[model samples]
Target chain A: MTENNYIYAPSEHPADKFRCKVPMKGTRQLFVIDGGVQGTAAPLSIKFDEGNCSDEILQVIGVRTSSGPKELSSESSFSFGQNSQGRLILCSHTFAEDPFITKEKIKISLAPNSSVDIVLMQNEHNDAEHISEFEIDIQRDASLRMVFLTLHGGKISNNIKVNLNGENASCDLNGLYIVDGKQQVRNLVSMNHKDPHCYSSQLFKGILDDASVASFSGLIHVWPDAQKTQAYQENHNLLLTKEAKVYSEPQLEIYADDVKCSHGATNGRLDENELFYLRSRGIPKKEAQLLQQQAFAYAVLDKISSEELKERMVSLTEQRLRGEFSKCKNCCKNCC
Target chain B: MLNIKDLHASIGEKEILKGINLQVKPGEIHAIMGPNGSGKSTLSSVLAGRDTYTVTSGEIEFEGKNILELSPEERSIAGIFLGFQYPIEIPGVTNVNFMRTAVNEHRKAKGLEPLNAAAFLKIMREKMEVVEMNPSFSSRGVNVGFSGGEKKRNEIFQMAMLEPKLAILDETDSGLDVDALRIVATGVNKLKRPDNATIVITHYQRLLDYIVPDIVHILYNGQIIKTAGKELALEVEKRGYDWLING
Candidate 1:
């Protein structure tokens, strides 16, 4: 058995690292874990048997660290006969000057029916790259939902690939990114439907200001046998400044004849009418803007299934928008 | 409670309120009636210290202080409230939260203690009754999804919550149905006190019928051309502004 499944460390390592010491016995036991101290690096790895544990136990994973950048990597093989569920959460972060430097990857080979919810929240400084890859093999009757919230980041790129290997599989990807002050973000998503009755949807929205830039590139491919496939993609951007830039490209390749697919992209500034409406209420221009922005970005944070993570993300978003880190005090309790 | 002497204000470089003069005593209502471009709304905006309007040469005194020198929020804290001709809609921020903030801001400036959650909610419930506003309305964002009349009522609701010394209702009667108009006027009348004053800026006399003002002033070509007792509002309503302006 792995002894490191539950361990706490101080903030001393230049880069904290942890590998699950649990042996690969593929037990059907439920595992509950908590986070460690703030300023320490921790690398986590989880493995499971493809066939036996898939039908019995539901695996849950949580990552809450104030450390520079916590790392999580998971690998699983194909398993049928049972259903499995997995969830991952990251919160309360003060990124390293170059946080998220460690490379991470999650590979899943589904059997027939399995599901996963992977949520990544970047609420610290807006200057780090979350370089990670997620590879999923969707068997028949399997599903996956990837919800990402990038409220603050200087530069980020998320590359996710999902392959529907069996019929009757589905995947949904929803993301909201708000960039300000010359920040740049790029999200690249690719999904392949290889069998019939496969479905996929993607929605990405962004708000850019102060010469910030954002890009969304989505690709959906339907194989010849993937009949009755439904695919949709949309990317919307709101540029707060003239210098801000946004680029969106949604590519769809379908060989199936009977399919429904659509993609749309919209990029613009906030509603002037809405601004005037807020200003008329005696709310100062800056406060009005902050209120509107909170509403705009909250649409994404509300989707976080974890209440704790959702609250942390909202707090981080408010701090980022208020430029709080620039005026960071030692005991920042008012950040709530 | 309020005084405007030879007020001259403009939007951009164009003059909107040109050389206007008016005065309001405590407990009295003054309604300014005019056509579309006669600066009916400009007077209210200028009095409330709206930034878009540049008061070129105007002296507005609220309780004997030069209010033109105050910022919008500062003016609000000084008991100056403008029931916007077109109230704003702020999403995600509950009406209760916004009103509580405004109330506490004013209270804090007046050297009074801030209201705790319990006291604040209690006051909000009472004010909601003044405008016949739904109890749930306070939980929704400010003015968001409110109907035309509901928006006007919400404006009055906010006024009741803030309890400002001088309230400027800028066309609060506009877009309001007869029932809404009566409710809003009742809300205004209920809040009236010998120490508080109201300036109802409207284009019609229908609102005046419900909340009779002490005086009715005709604003033409950016200035007050005529002023008379409450009966003058009906005169304008009967014969229109042409009879008063041309005569």
Candidate 2:
């Protein structure tokens, strides 16, 4: 039972490079290694029993190492009891400069009448390869809000599958990814409506620059018995250069007749009229472009329920848009 | 304060303004009335440095300097403002943020310090009142979800904030109701100074009733066919442009 106001991993551990600005008060921070909790017996580790439930936020930081011959992998699971409320923050970062590969699997389950908010941030160096899968099960009268923020990475693939198994369950999922310089990021999301009177909605946006590429494939499936179900999904992308590319596919498969389902996808450049309008008001061209990009990214960032985290994410997103994260290796500034 | 001589401009291959000439002095308001497709908006766009229109020949001189090479932002920072007919809606950038950036840029161009947030808010609140805009509008996105009249009033509010030397209002009264028109007109008139000028481009003579112009120019087919005093607008309103074009 290690409880500290602020927990910092050992300076030698790779998790020390996790750059997220940690929030204050009632946070349990832990560092997991090599896909298992038994690798390092640190002060931050906490043993969780079946009945262990608290209202505090659980912050988990995972770091994968490619120094060994075996491929790195991580597996973690979390379940909440009925009528409980909690928050979870998962941040994964790889500091390896060489070719590295890692796979992570996360499972979350919410009991009846329970609610949870989850934020997953994936930031890795340009030479690293990572794949993450999230399986979420939401039950009767429970709700879930999840945000996936992919700030910097190379060859990152995120697979998220959500199942609303009980009546009156709802899920709101959002994602934002900004990639540049030959990086490639992909998001594959599938939402299942298995019960009646369930609702789900998703919004994902990305901004690609240089020769970066991004892909989004989202599906909404409704069962025949899932009457009175409502689902919506949208994915929008902004390509800054001719070389930048995006592939968006939003699909809906519905077996129920009395359900509402919609999906939309758009890939576009910055609006020239909007740009001209900004510049005509004396804002410089560069600033005007940044302003538009920031505005585009803010739509997803605004979904965060916590004002403290929202403000921090907004500032970080601004820095990322301003090209401040381009040369992260040699930069000595602690921007976070 | 502004002079345009033989301003032959075109969009792609289609010539819009053919050998147009106009002179505006300080402390004066000039009204240019014409029918649709007569290149009234084209003249305004050309003056505000919109890149869609190319100046095939001629020069635009502002305060003794040729401004044909200036970018839209440079023109704006150099004290040229164009009140758009349809104000653009920027969904996430608030009016305060947009106007603060613009005002700071203008101040920077003049070698002055940028206004702090407190000082900027004070000025914004004051200017917003000139258009009778609610204080809440300052926190909203620039013209996002605003009505037609609200958009027009926002343009006038922005003009008041920038305090340009040459303010060009292009069809600003088209969508505005009578009350909104009076508010916008009063805002423009209140900002008038001895060193500033305005060019009101409209198709209706009704706007001239509120902000009376010292010179009125009737444009037809990319050329000014007639130039007269304030009485010209009343005559055009009564007899229509056919009588003037024929006589």
Candidates' DockQ values? 0.25, 0.83
Against the hidden true structure, what lDDT does model 1 obtain?
A: 0.71
| lDDT of each residue in B1-247, candidate 2, tens digit only | 7989999999999999998899999999999998889999999988988899999999899999999999999999999999998889998888998999999999999999999999999999999899999999999988999999999999999999898999999998998899999999999999999999999999899999999999999998898989999999999888889987787
Model 1 clash pairs are A2-A21, A2-A22, A16-A41, A18-A43, A55-A82, A126-A153, A126-A154, A127-A154
User: Roughly what TM-score does model 1 have, to 2 decimal places?
Assistant: 0.78
lDDT of 1 by residue, A1-336 (tens): 123432333223333332222211332222212232223223344433333333222223233234423443333222222265655443223324444432345565555776656566555455454454667777888777767777765566777788988888888788888788877788888989899898888888787878888999999998999999989988888788899888899899989999999999988767665555444445556766776777767666667665655665677677767766522223332221
TM-score per candidate: 0.78, 0.92
Candidate 2 CAPRI grade: high
